[model samples]
Target: MTKGRRRTTRDADHESFDTAYDAIMARWPDGTESLTVPTPYGPTRVHACGPRGAPPLVLLPGGGATSAGWYALAAELSKTHRVFAVDLVGDAGHSAPDPQRPVRSVGDLTAWLDALLDGLSIGLPSGPPVDLCGHSYGAWIALHYALHAPTRVRRTVLLDPTGCFAGFRASYLLRALPMLLRPSARRVRRFLEWETAGGAPLDPALLRLQERAAVLPAVRPVTGPRPDPAALRGLRCPVLLLLAGDGRAHDPHRVAARASAVLPEVTATVLPGVSHHVLPYAMHADVHGRTAAFLGPLSRPSR
Candidate 1:
């Protein structure tokens, strides 16, 4: 009976999470399509939109933010580029994790990304390199992938990325401890409230989805040391590093200084009045303008 009850509770948590996710997705622009691309890790869920022949721009959301969280930004980028917003493997969204092939390390994570890109038919031989953009933890993944396969990526964008250039603020880690140690809806909400303090109000639907994320069965995310500074200096692709001026996660100025100094080709900017968790969403207009400017005009239709 105990086992059965546990199973039932897990099922309910998944249901609630989907309901909230769907609610948020319902607001996405017209013609948006959700498809699953199979990878060795699992079937990755991607929300695709924009013209089919346009250059692909992949968006990776922060941890627990889900692909649906990119709705607003996706809509903007989709106008000029095909947008593929992904639900990361082993996370709380629609993507399923292969228990047998768990992503155990940063190496595994990069391999999973390679398979995912191949499944999507991106990169050399057939298709041109795609632009990669990510936020927070997702930004970490994007940076690592760019380093792993520079030839496969045309450009990269990192939005308030953590653990890439600077260490996390000790106070920020302390506040996240409760949610990390004993995750609950209340704890998740509390964490967001504290971190996003002084930022514009967040979308209610997005908040609901995040709260439900706490109860969903999720795999432990891969964690590792910061990328080597030597590797940063070696990266060749154009990069846009956008920091949240009010972010409590780390010193935005310090991040800017380090990134500008190490990266061979980088454009770093700080968007004031927004915090880490509320970014891209909070500074929608500013983020879109800078991103589109950096990405330049859309690609010509594939021959």
Candidate 2:
């Protein structure tokens, strides 16, 4: 691949996106309103479910995951909170992809989200402080937002956040090293299967999205050794950390212990036998109940 050369999606990619979009939309509640929030780089797509007047809550999926990654579980989430599921930019969702200017810094990602919330009127000025939840890569993103933009966030939920408390396993790096050096369709499929072995097959759109992400020359902006103990200590809002038992991405138990010690207001839960990829989707009702209990009900500000 040439340095200046950009990777454009072929026709097959379009087909995959179309197929996944239909499947994803079918899973959403009957009248989900889709909105496009404009950003400096481009537009981001947000899928709103539940009552419009309900407390605004944002849901962010893991890296290479589309907005619908939360489809199987969004229903339960929307029951108590107005869920604003986001199709993060630079990923395979309907949002625009700017490979030439990949979000490389945390500030860039934060500002992108700031514009999104402002566009949706999802915070104190408009209503109430937004509640944020993220899984895997998204958990790291959510944590960053809470730390840097404290005023905008209320309660936060981090589920098996990658790179926050612990780094990726050496085994994962070793297994993925070959794909990094020479990414191919077959390798991508194999990696996906490995990550989601017990779970169901990913929607075609997300599969295609991950395929493109695997070969991208530039890296997406990600959370580094962030939300460190110092940052965690400063957070005024409560944080819920859900750990996946026997997780390979990070040591869940270790993270739970560390977070408990450093954060003033934090709760930790470890789900037995669950892995990194198998998240709230695997136990929708259980996760939903816990999330609702932790967050309680939304309280809009008075006029």
C-alpha lDDT of candidate 1 relative to the true structure? 0.88
The lDDT, on a scale of 0 to 1, for candidate 2 is 0.75
Instruction: Name the best candidate (by lDDT).
Output: 1
lDDT of 2 by residue, 1-303 (tens): 668876666544566556656565777887888888887757889899988788788999887666776776678778877899998887756778455656767888888889889888887565688999999889989988898888889899988888777677787777666766787656877776676565444455556556655544334446466667787888877889988775667677888897888788788988766667767455545466778787784364322
Candidate 2, TM-score vs. the true structure?
A: 0.86
Whole-model lDDT per candidate: 0.88, 0.75
Cα deviation of 289 in candidate 2 (Å)?
Answer: 1.9
**Considering summed lDDT, which 10 consecutive residues are worst modelled in model 1?**
294-303
Against the true structure, whose TM-score is highest?
Answer: 1
TM-score of each: 0.94, 0.86
